[model samples]
Target: MTQQTSGEMRIEKDSLGEIAVPAGHLWGAQTQRSIECFPIGTARFVWRRPVIRAFGILKKSAAIANGELGQLPADKVAMIVKAAQSVIDGDVDEEFPLVVFQTGSGTQSNMNANEVIANLAIRNAGGKLGSKTPINPNDDVNRGQSSNDTFPTAMHIAIVEEISRDLFPAVTQLRDTFERKGRQFDDVVMVGRTHLQDATPVTLQQVFSGWVAQLDEALAAITATLPALYALAIGGTAVGTGINAHPRFGDVTAAKIAAETGHAFISAPNKFAALSAHDAVANTSGAIRTLAGALMKIANDVRWYACGPRAGFNEITIPENEPGSSIMPGKINPTQCEALTMVAVQVFGNDAAVAFAGSQGNFQLNVFKPVMLHNVLESTMLISDACRAFDTFCAKGIEPNRAKIETNLKNSLMLVTALNPHIGYEKSAKIALLAHKEGSSLKEAALNLGFVTEQEFDAWVIPADMTHPLPE
Candidate 1:
């Protein structure tokens, strides 16, 4: 809703020159320059709520640290902190109008936040908006910090917050659902497929167990990356030298951030590495990529398992929540699984973008902060939402097609593998081949070939036991 026509305009000036800014907008010159300079996409940083909130939190923390250090007066610090709180509460989302494709260093976004917070502080303190008198964007709001460090710090904090607050719980819920299904289907045995061909007898519970394990591993890997991410890149200022930043700034700001976020936020051990490289973020992206792979596998498994009532695997029926087809009658697609799979693909894409962005760090700063943060935050939100959706829409509603499972289990030639321990591999293979050739059950083929007695076949060919074999 930018006034493309004749709305009131205000003049804002930066180091470059004066520009016509929207009259009511809180963002000032740098943000205005970014708006006019790079009209790349309508996509703005407004969608990145976590990043913005983290920026707010970082600003508030910095103000507190600076105030305690006597760098800024207490009144201005209080005003800045309150303004930053407004940002955290999402009271001024419209104030931030910069896009993710702005300067690679995210200086524009940093200024956007500074300007918004400063104007709000001015208004709260009974001063005029756009009057940077007591609450200057640079001297007060952005004191002792630079986009080089603060942006990356915000990126890390936001991602860590999203993962801990949202994504981990969603994934854990999905994992727990899989565990529930595992126990529920413990005795329901079916033919296990490898390379899309029958391989051995496996209980449905065991398949679910494997799924739970995959999710567990993925969640564990993602969680393991948190410690690295908790190390903030703040207080490094323009470069790794700590420039105008106080020596106490890094630790105090980190402590304040940790207090606000409820996460263990630590100052980066090496400011140079934190500012100049984004390997931690890259490691996080890699973890998410691994989780995406797991989700893709699980979603595809569910989709394939619920494929058809008359054609495919058809061993489970997903809940019919909506009419799946326009013309076809009584059609219920595995839409949730399809959605989850698509999300997995999208996360994969986001991770690729994040990985590439993370590597784009040149010398004293990574210029790809905005895109990196956008992609990482997008991946976190998508995966979290997809996990929740898959759990509620698909996992919770899965119905075992016991009749089909039994039918397939009874007819499967791979059941002969269960007889290997008792009858030897060669004889088992022969029995399996005979069953396939004659279109007979392994039991029937074994009986015809006199490979074993009925009593022995019944004793040794228990599918449930095959899922968890007692040590030979």
Candidate 2:
């Protein structure tokens, strides 16, 4: 078939039909048909680089497995491996142009990778491009795989790589920053709020400790999902029967991917379970969802604590990265917190889509894989970036307002709870009510009401000691 046309287009044909492809593109007939079909939004596998690289790694492993099984010729394997390495090295990202909303099984994107690698190999061997003679995309490039298995395999590889390389470090750094600040503010006692109402006294360090605990739980949730995510579906070609694929293809391909990524990529014990369901991806998305909620809570707390300099809590100060209002002057805002909170909302939404996609898997394969993986990667990237921003701009620069903290601690009516042991619960409640009604301090109301002497009040209601359990 004649590939090149007048200037910038080429004719390409697949089983379905023929279409005009861009003259310079590495994609072939199937990809061209997808471009003509599915005119969805412009979110072309937003994580294209990582997703493509994962495909590169998958194809390379497949070539090695096929070669070892005597299914592919040595020279063809060599050409495929070398070309796939370039994909892994991020050399041909421009070639994969399909969006995430395409075919339910991600076949279009898989074929896109196959065609590109096949073209690269042919070109390197000094053959005419677009000529699928010696290196057929389906036969040579995707030797022992189906989109059903390969797409999910790529999804797992990309998610694991991103979490290990990006999300873990950013979240760990943010947690460390919170802990460091916790130590710095350990001695500064402030009024604690419950249900957004003044409740009791607590050290600023203790408040930050809560944030640290939230992140700790989030990190643990993510780490726990790794074993499931490492289970790849590569060997379960077509419908998890290893049909048309070597018996050892799954084991060998998984080992090669593990070696390439320096991570443990394991073959699924049950191919049917791995192929028919995406419980692993769903579980990972749930963990990420929990992380998003945790970060959102932390960000909201920071913004609330730094609400106002004169009217709000004013107990803590966060780094103000931008102006709070368009018209208000000298009004710095917690921009990092705002940005992180927005990302958290987005993750929440993405998790819903991922969970729905996971549940949509029929008997053999999940058609919503592209959308599921797309949402997962988007959530990962957003959370990772938000964590870094929060650590750099907000958590690290946070400082305590000692004067405000001391003033609030001294005037809080809730501190009267300490008098319960010395006097009685009934009498302490009376004094607290009196203090609030008369707009007087707890100590003054107690003194005026003759509940306790100043000496006794001072001895019983110690703010520092009230923060935690008494001596014994």
Among the numbered candidates, top lDDT falls to: 2
lDDT of 2 by residue, 1-472 (tens): 1223457877777786667877787889898777768778888875778899899999999998899989999999999999999999988888888877899899999999999999899889988767886799998899889999999999999999999999999999999999999998799988889998888898989988999999999989999999998999999989999899889999999999999999999898888778778989999999999999999999999989888888988888887677778898898877888899999999999999999989997898888899989999999999999999889988999999899888889989999989998899999999999999999999999999998999999899998888998677
* Cα RMSD for candidates in order: 1.6, 2.3
Give the alpha-carbon lDDT of every model.
Answer: 0.87, 0.90
TM-scores, one per candidate: 0.96, 0.97
lDDT of 1 by residue, 1-472 (tens): 2423358887777678787877777878787787778878766655568878999999999999999998999998999999999999999887776777888888988998998899888888887767786699999999999999999899888989989989999999999999998899887888889999877778888899899999899989988999999999998988888999989998999999999999999999899989888988889988998999999999999999888879888998888889989999988898888888898898889888888888877888888888888888888888999999889988998878999998887787887878887889999999989888888778888999998999999998887777775775
Model 2 bad stretches (over 4 Å): 1-6
In angstroms, the error of model 2 at 37 is: 0.7
Off by over 4 Å in 1: 1-5
Cα lDDT over the full model 1? 0.87
